[model samples]
Target: MLTSSTFSYAIGLILQSIAARRTITSNSIERGLVIRLATDRCYAWGLAAQVAGFLLAFYARETLPVYLVQAAACAAVGVAAVMGAVAFGWRVTRAEAAVLAVLTVALVLLAGAAEPSRVTAVPPATGWVLTALLASCLALAPAAWRARGAVPLAGLAGAAFAVLAVASRPLPALDVTALPLQPLAWLTLAAAAVGQILLAAALQRGSTTSAGSAMDAVTMVAASAAGLALVGDRIADGRTAWLVVGLILVVAGVLAMARVGTVVGEPIRHTDNDVADQPITQGNAR
Candidate 1:
């Protein structure tokens, strides 16, 4: 389920990136508008993919430890990075490749060290925590919007996603008939939507490598903490040290991926009138 979700997310991102590039290059006014429409459509598809991924992930969290599920999902970053390199022509340095490889190993270790999640009914306090998290993300959105860099926006998005992950812990089993009746389910959906919007905005504002890394790192830490505190998730017997080491490596690798520069083929060229709206930046190039 996690693997399938990651593939869906990668495909969605690639489509959205392609559409964004098309929107920038259309020669005729009508053609530009059409391209813009297509870009929006692509974004919708991306959103759908993300929503589906989150649902599957949330459902899995019921049985799997949070760190394990999250680690598996965060692997989507690698998929996105590779797609960006191949589809958008972003060049990955050898160092970036090395870091990604380390990240993969760390995920494996984290998963191996995770004990099964404690399955229990949702506690009342869980609702309050989810509300607070949602409110915090809302408060940060405006500030992230005003920031010049993608890190703030990406971080906010990651945090919002963490909230969704936490909320998902108590979610009633996914049922077409009963899910809509649950308030927590609605809250989870709202949080996912907000996270996706913020992430997309962040990606538009800067390099995917940077934005994706920030999102993944923040989500891993935040979600793991929430899982431990709110859902009583624990490491496998005598595996605390392993979990800690794996987490450190995961964070280090994510930061390394963020710092590595990406070089895309045929730089996105913008017309004079479109210059201010041009989203690509040289900062993304090493």
Candidate 2:
């Protein structure tokens, strides 16, 4: 499941990146942007791949530590780099290859250190924590649409994805009928919705590597921390050193990826009348 999800995420993101690039070049109108993101054949297929990845990750989390699961999921960045090359002729630099190598080693160690926890039910405080985090993202969103803010928007979307992942921790343990009444389940939907919107916006304004790497870094770290502190996820016995070293390597790789995004063959096109301060939806779409 983990390995498959890694590829699915990579493929989905790559396709979505292509879709985003196409729309930004020729599309106009505010609401039309969102519509195109959904209706564009490439984007829709990309979304389907993401949904498959989500399902795979959802079940994988049932047996692994959240840190391990999240890290493994974010490993898609390396995959995306290679796929981008195939799909868009993006070149991976020497530095990127090194980062991908380090990232792979880190994932191996993290996987080795993960221990399946018996704790399945989410703590009551989790929902409240998710609510607070969701509110925080909403507050940060306005600033994300400003000039040169695509990375920040990606970060916020990552935070939301983290929230939803954490919120999903207890879902499999719950009775099917109880989901509708469960506040966390509802919060999960809201977080997923918000994350997708912000992520789309981020893709609209940023390079795939920059936006995706940022989102993956934030999502893995935030979700891993929340899982450890709030939800009792555990490292394997006598493997604390492995977890620590693995996390350090993960951080190093993610930071490197964020610094250098896998850009497409051509530079992003800009029209003469383009807005400088914000996205078209914000300025002229009104």
Candidate 3:
């Protein structure tokens, strides 16, 4: 029985992978088809890394509870950030590291306090879920078109993300094959992919932290609730309730740290100097 927190980290990593692919895809046109192919290759490697990490996480889960797994996932961000620095020569300053450290600690403590064994039943396939996801995408189009900032775009994308998260984790009560082939599932999937692309572009345009915050919030809440409501996840006891609280705190901590980073790393500058100025205004002050 995995808790909501566990799912949150898992989904966060999934979104992070999507964001990474978006980063590569951004230059698809300028880099040409060959670059696109290369980007796909990189995407494959990232997927592989995730798979390996998950396998390790599963093993870690055996000795530790779900919270530990979530904490471990938080730790992986530090690894990823360092990889970004070492492999690509992307510099990481003390402030960024500090923020990430605080996030890691919060997640670790949350995980330590969380309860274990909260399993949801696998949902049966249903047409309505698909329909709802499709409707969400259609609704988001105009909003996306009109979106002026990263936040709005992230919000729109978050809407689509909510659809996918809810649709993917279908209610446990339903039958798989009995369920109609959902156009909504496909649509929501497409929306999620595209939303991520838009999210990455917005992040690049301004604040990665802000974009990350939006992505994290939208995806986590959408997925967790879907798991709970439709799939039969329960917080029926003290341990489970405490675990849920820890997860929320963990999520809040990560987003808070990200927001702090956004504020400290002002003016949207990508250089060391951007963060060198201390916790000034968020992104290239207007």
lDDT of 2 by residue, 1-286 (tens): 8899889988888767666755553222245777878877778988889888888887787667778877877888778887767765668888888889999999999989999864557667778988999999998787676636357888998999999888877676667899899888899889988888888887776666677878888998899889888778888889999998998788678778867645443433334553233322221211
Q: What TM value does model 2 have?
A: 0.87
Evaluate all candidate structures by whole-model CA lDDT and list the values in order: 0.69, 0.77, 0.46
Best-to-worst TM-score order = 2, 1, 3
Query: In model 1, what is the error at residue 272, expressed in angstroms?
Result: 21
Model 3 clash number: 11
Report lDDT (Cα) of residue 213, candidate 2.
78
Please identify which of the two predictions, 2 or 3, would achieve the higher lDDT against the true structure: 2
lDDT of 2: 0.77
> Candidate 2 — worst ten consecutive residues by lDDT sum?
277-286
Candidate of highest lDDT: 2
| Residue 236's lDDT in candidate 1 | 87
Off by over 4 Å in 3: 1-79, 109-134, 170-194, 260-286
lDDT of 1 by residue, 75-185 (tens): 666676676677666677798788779878987898789886555557778778877888898887877767776688789888888888877776634565777877777
